[model samples]
Target: MTMSRRAFVKTSAAASLSVIAASAKAAAYPTRPITLIVPYGAGGPTDTIGRIIAEGLREALNGTIVVENVAGASGTIGVTKFYRSPNDGYTLCLGNWPTFVLNGAIFKAPYDVTKDFEPIGRVVTDPQIIISRPDLPANNLKELIAWFKSNGDKATQATGGTGSTSHVAGILFQHKTDTQFAFVPYRQGVGAAMVDLIAGRVDTMFSVAANAIPHLKSGAVKAYAVTAKERLGIMPDIPTVDEAGLPGFYTANWHALFAPKGTPKPILEALNAALVTALANPDIRKRMEDVGQTLPPKEQQTPQALTQLLKDDIATWWPVVKEAGIKNE
Candidate 1:
């Protein structure tokens, strides 16, 4: 069909206006206060990281970045809320390993971890550091496995309730070693569990690096291995899982930024740029590092890196969670 000259001009003008409007929208992104939703309660690692990112974003974006803690249901409640929120860049979901990946397996989450959101950038990562009571009769990973195999039923692995990184990783540990240790859930928090471990009441723990760092430094708990490819900087003496007789058993509780799936690419780029800026700040880096957290390498700080991290975790964890019948508390 041949278009009339007048009709052609009108169509071209409309298309140009649409393009200009979209660009303006992207450029004026975060025109209002941007809400960064932390899917956990205050004072937790995830919440702390969320606030750090929010502070950095508040400065980097040069706009108001308000942090809202939507804590509950192992972080599923807040994430579900975010999954249903507007796709506009103003509402960002700050998620980590459990809220974004593990919870989806334990609970019937409404959103898909690998599909329901657009990535901004991965902020920080804390390796899973396996620990035991100082006198557990297992000084290293190899002996620990041997001990667990013989004393599986009597052994207890303390965790911060079910479906947490510690609990899920504990399940993975059991499966990997063919051990049958029982899980001890702490309603108060893992800090309580750590105390028990320090007192030699609990047998072992699959702890985050931050929680285990001070204890490791003080010789309060026996350090087995860090479940990551590389050794942790703060506790450089701890060996990686690959080097600790349990090869290829890597896991981390990581933080990253996300918006609802349909956000524009320009907006995602803007968000990622701000995140990169925050990660590069010496003070911000020190704060995270002080907590035993490591910033993602500059090369892996992009939205694509974040997307890969999500898909990779989902692939690595969902099956283990299902096979182990890990359930939410």
Candidate 2:
């Protein structure tokens, strides 16, 4: 049926107005404060990194950014919240391996990492450090291995949670070293696990360098080895796990930014540009470097790079997790 001339004109005007409004919205971009969701509790390494990035974004975008911690379920709960939010670019999530890769590999998460989120950019990557109570009779990785071998299941290893980065590192370490520990899990975050390590309640843990550095310096925890190919400049005296007799042992924890799937491309580009600017600031670079956080090379700091990294990590870890029978508790 042919439409009336008046109705046709009115419909055309409405469609044109909608297009203009959307374009205006994209140009205005973040007219209001953005909420950045940190998928871990406050005071943990992830939270610290998230807050730092949030501050940088606030400066770069010239807008307010509020970081909200929605910690639980190895970070999946917070990430799920992010996935379900409107894709208007107002909500974002600061996610890492636990939330983005491990949870999907080990458990039936509510969202898919590759399908449910739009990659923003990677902020930092931190190597894992094997640390133990200061009194643990182990000064280096070799001695630590020996101690574990002798103590067998008597030695305790602390993990942030069952499917957490710490847990994955612990599993890989045990598998490599042919040793076992009585695992103790803290579902909240690494804050409590660090506390227990400091107080000698737990014997050891594989921790992100950022979270373990201060304690390592304060003489509260003994650093056994870093889970990187080389010693970090910030802690050059610490030997790498490979140098300390665990050949081919390397693992790292990384943080990346993401918006819900279907966010406008212009908004995503703006966010990525802001992130690149934040990462280039001298103060930000220095602060991250001081904590042993390594920024990705310039080319690898883009959304495409982050997307590829997520896919690669899922491919690399899924089989290992499945073979080891790691399951979310």
Candidate 3:
């Protein structure tokens, strides 16, 4: 394609204008209050993290960032609203392993998680724990597996919902231990499921450390083991999966920031930069850690790192979910 000098100059001028306009837009971003949707109910782990992130964002962006909770359908309800929101950097979704990765595989989500969002940054990590009703006979992960193997038919596992992290972790646990237990799906979230486990209505539940820490400390539920390589600082008595005789079975509930798809690159970069700055703040880091959340390394707190993580998780988990016949319907 050959262009005359006049045409070339016109095209160059247009390109220059676009770059300047984009830069201006980025600078004036968040002219209004932004909404951060927490896909679960208030007081849950996701909401807790979302509120903290919202506060951090308010400081980092020097703009108003409001957090709204839209619960149900394994977080699809809130995420769908986020998907439908305008891609003007005004609305964001605080997504995690379940809603962004597990839901796509297990349910017919209204939006495409893989294609319909722009990653801002990877934020926090909360390790999961395998806990049972206070009355469960098993005292440790090894004995728990043995008991589940013997009483698979009668055992019931509690989950946040059909495609939630707890539900998927339950399936993976069965495969690893060669045991099968009926799942008790709670539409609300794990808090509701935790109630059942505490009341002895369900046999076991895979819970995040943030949610399980209080119950474990209160002696409401029997803790088996944490699902990470390292033990949690708050619950030092608990052992890691490897130490608990379940090697290589690690599960964590991690979180990341996301904006609606088609958001401008400049706006995306601004959001990412704000998040990176907020994460580096000592107060934000301390608050997250106090709730049993662990922040990623500085190198991993970027749009590129989060994008690769989402892709890799989708590739790794979708096939496994399908092969196991795990579906919300």
> Which one is best on TM-score?
2
Q: Per-residue CA lDDT of candidate 3, range 12-48, in tens?
A: 9999998899889999997999999998888678888
Candidate 1 at residue 264, lDDT? 77
- For model 3, give the RMSD to the true fold: 2.0
Give model 3's clash tally: 0
Whose lDDT is greatest here? 3
Off by over 4 Å in 3: 1-15
* Candidate 2: tens digits of C-alpha lDDT, residues 111-136: 87768899999999999999999999
List TM-score per model, in order.
Answer: 0.83, 0.94, 0.93
Q: Which wins on lDDT, candidate 1 or candidate 3?
A: 3
Give the Cα lDDT of each candidate.
0.84, 0.89, 0.90
> What is the C-alpha lDDT profile of model 1 across 47-158, one tens digit per residue?
6677877889988999999898876677777888999899888899988888788887888888888788888889998888999998888888999999989997798899
Position 111, candidate 3: lDDT? 85
Clashes of 2: 0
Off by over 4 Å in 1: 1-12, 133-139, 142-154, 186-203, 218-222, 242-245, 327-329
